[model samples]
Target chain A: METFILIGITGIGLGALYFLIASGLSLIYGLMGVLNFAHGSFLTVGAFVGFWVASKMGFETSMPEFILAMLVGGLAAGLFALLIEQLLITRLYDRHIDQALVTVGVSLVVGAVLGGWFGNDLRMFPAPLWFLSAIDIGGAKIPADRVVYIATAVLLLVGNWALLKFTRIGLIIRAGVENRNMVNALGINVRRAFSTVFFLGGFAAGVGGVLVSVYSNGVSPLIAATYLIYGFIVVVIGGMGSVPGSFLAAMMIGVIRQFANYYATGLGDFVVVILLAVVLLIRPQGLLGKVRS
Target chain B: MLRWKYSRPLLGLLIALLALAPILGANPLSRPGLQQTMAVAFIWGGLALTYDLLFGFTGLLSFGHALYFATGVYVSCILINHEVVVWWLAALISIAVSALLALLVGAASLRTTGITFAMVTLAFGEAGHVIIQRNFFNLTGGENGIALNADRIPSLFISVANTKFIYWAALAALIFTYAVIWWVTESSAGRVFAALRDNELRVQVLGLNTQRYKLLAFVISAALAALLGAVMLIAAGSAAPRFADAGVTISLLLMVVLGGAVTRWGAVIGGIFYSIATTRMQDLTQQESFKTIPKWIGGPIAEPALVLGLLFIFVVMFAPGGLSGAYYRLRLRAITKKSQ
Candidate 1:
């Protein structure tokens, strides 16, 4: 029972990390209908930026300074997203396949650049101040950092949910997702909205990058290729245009992956895909996804 | 003034030059390397043409094409391992296996269009890759991959060098592939593929089963890809899972896009051009002059991937119609001026 709890907690932490990354993909797909294949690379960029900031600022001994590092990393990632959208994605939005292909190209470019710059070695930032000790629950001990990640993810989810459900921008975004032409005709600047969503989405991916980098104890060049595919799987399983759906799906994938890791050696990557296939068969539009009339 | 009308003579001259290359030239393709590259390129070009049959013409881009290619490659490679020395017979079986797989995958996947289709194809491709990779100890040979001795062809041809035989075989296959594409593109079925591309709903409203047509297109494409894989195995003397990896699929897609996808000969030219240019770029930059800029711009930025990435970006942003499109435009201009 204790072991299960520990496993479940780890799973929750993973799910949270996934949610941060996948939510951005969901929003971009929802509003712009662009798959953003380079989103994982964007997260990677952020992670690397955070590492650079920590190193550059000489925050070697400081744990609390990583938040500042994360912010800087996220800003850089957002800027890169903006540049990609402005230069390439804007031209290919009408052609989704082309959009996918271009983003794939972007992924290769970013990955290569990152590898060239960072030298393929993994680097970690100092942990947050709150994660100094492990917490014991019943007979199970869980890392304080893992709890912090879960809390941060939940907080972000609630904050995003509230923003989407209650804010004017969220309402506009929802409208845009349903029908971009209609939203444009209703006097909303759809392009600006799209740019805004991309920025927010990129910001979320950046945060996920920082969290995952810290969680895994470092960032590696190959991590983008590895986890980007997983993020895509999560988005597909959750439903492309659904935010809450991603949250639910992320948790499921996270838990299932943890279970698979424990049960099946050397089969972590495809567990999500198998689950995705099963989900796709039962509900083609995906779980929490409304059927397209 | 009417000199260009005899284009067939020019084509014949090119073929003659290719035939005489081994004797006259010192390049790799002139001697032992000719067979390997030609066979590989012909097979790959055939696959690209098939991809264009669906994507360039039909507008249905399936990223999971490697699935069918793998199916055929693995089957043929396994048969060869078991001493199935007859190339023609193995090719038929391989084509059949791949065609069936294409039919199944296309049938299910063609139900959805656009992003869903792309995602499903990717799913299938990944599944295929993982399945082959995990069953390493058995048929796949795991990471190390299965190696075979030299491929055995029919005893009809005289005892020539392995490279010369391979060159002739690949050239013949290339001719056959080109003929098939030419016939298919001019056929009634080809017209329907075009219609399906234009508007599937409209075709369905016309009482045509667009899905059936799409499946047919997919199966044909898969067979060609499989045939190409057989040639590759024969040429390389081995089959690795990397043949079915996503990079090859993307590279093929890039070739189609860069060669003007809708044109019949575009894929062939594109494949040859992409292969030659990418392969030769490293050698070209090996000159003292080319190395300095790459070093200065970014240390060792002269890598093929960097060059490829830059080239692809340029093509996407500027040369949307690709090299073949430029050729067509030039041809049109020349013809119009002559008439005037």
Candidate 2:
């Protein structure tokens, strides 16, 4: 029971991170119809930036410092994404395959640049001392950091949902995702809306990256590839362009991965891939995605 | 109409060039490293040709094509290393197994369209790489990779140690692969592939089975890729799990697009050019003079992948048709000017 509870907690924490990353990818794909392969690079950028800020700030234990670091990290990533969107992505808007290839190229270049700058070694983000402590929750001792991460993820998810549901900009994005051409014809400036959504998605990925680095204790150049694959799997299983579906799929993958990691070691990834293939075969539209006409 | 007249002479010229490559490469006036580079180039060219069949002609963008290639290399090498079969028979068996694997992957992945198809294949490729690296450690030698004993290789084939033999063999393979692709593309089925690429819905409405044609293309492309993989194993004397890496698939896609998709000959040219460019770029980075530059400025230059990425973006934005497309446009201009 103890082991199961621990596993469940860890899985949920990891799922929260995946949810953040995959939601960004799904949102962008929904609105812009581009897979944004470079989304993983945003995560890497966020983690590294957060690490740099936290380290430079001298290992402060205050919650405010950590929040500031995360904000800076996310904003940096968002700015980078905005530049990329303006410079390269805007040219290949409707060309799906070209967009995929171009984004992949961007990812490779960004990864290489980061590796060059950071010397290809894993860099750690110093977590606040209080968050590092363990807390007793109903007879089970859980790491305080896990609880913080899960709480942050839940907050972000709820905030995003509210923003989409209540705001005019969010409504425009929702409409654009369903039918971009129609949204454009309706004179709502869909291009600007898509660009904003892209920025927001990158910001989410950045936040996820900061959280992951804090939890994992370090970040490496390879994180882009690893998380990109996970993000892709989540988006696929959750159905492309579906935020809630991404959230559900991310949690399921997280728990399954934890279980597989404990029982099978190296087979965890293979099992996830097999599950993806099976899901694709049985439910081509994804679990929560609407059927495309 | 113009293509019909020019294609025959173009093919003849290509065959003649390939036949003359070994001789040209071995000449004293040629650069010292040219022979080995050309041999590898031909091998990659063959792989890219097969890739074009799927991505360019058939309109399927598979990101896991390296799975088939690596399967061919590992299976053939394992069989030969274990003395279960001769090299020729091992190659044939590898092709069969690779085709079977392709069929399964195609069946599962082909159900989705566009980006979904690409992601599924990418997942499968990553899984295959991990399995080869971990699950089959004994058979695959894990991360260290499996090396075949030189003496165990059959005497009928030239030893892998001989660069000349490998070069000639790779050239022959490239030629043979090109001929096969050319034949297929020229035939009725090839027309059907082009049609499918243009509009799968229209073909389905015309009472043709689009799925069958796609499967056929997938199987053929996989088999050809596996054949090249076997040839590579024979040349290199070892196979690594990295052969199945997603990077390989991306590189193959880059080569196809760089050469010009849908143009059979373009893939060959692109593959050769990419191979040469990458090799030269790596060599340039490792030079003593290159290290003299500051880390921040020259750091990315040492990473070939960065350069490749920048090149891909440039190509996508400025020259979507690739080198072949550029050549065709120039030639069209020349013809028009001459007529005027």
Q: Highest lDDT: which candidate?
A: 2
**What do the candidate models score in CA lDDT, each in turn?**
0.75, 0.84
**lDDT per residue (tens digit) for residues A1-293 in model 2:** 77788778878888888888899898888788787889988888888887788788785547888888888888888888888888888888789889888888888898878877777777767778887777776566778888877887788789889988999999998888888888888888887777787788888888888888877677777776767788888999999888899989988988888889888887778888989989998999888987887
* DockQ score for candidate 1: 0.39
Interface RMSD of 2: 1.1
Model 2 regions lying over 4 Å from their true place: A59-62, A129-144, B1-33, B155-161
Task: Compute the lDDT of residue A131 as modeled in candidate 2.
Answer: 77
Off by over 4 Å in 1: A57-62, A119-149, A214-217, A267-271, B1-20, B23-28, B82-91, B149-161, B284-296, B333-340
CAPRI class of candidate 2: medium
What proportion of the real contacts between chains A and B does each prediction keep? 0.17, 0.66
* Worst window of 10 by summed lDDT in candidate 1 chain A: A57-66
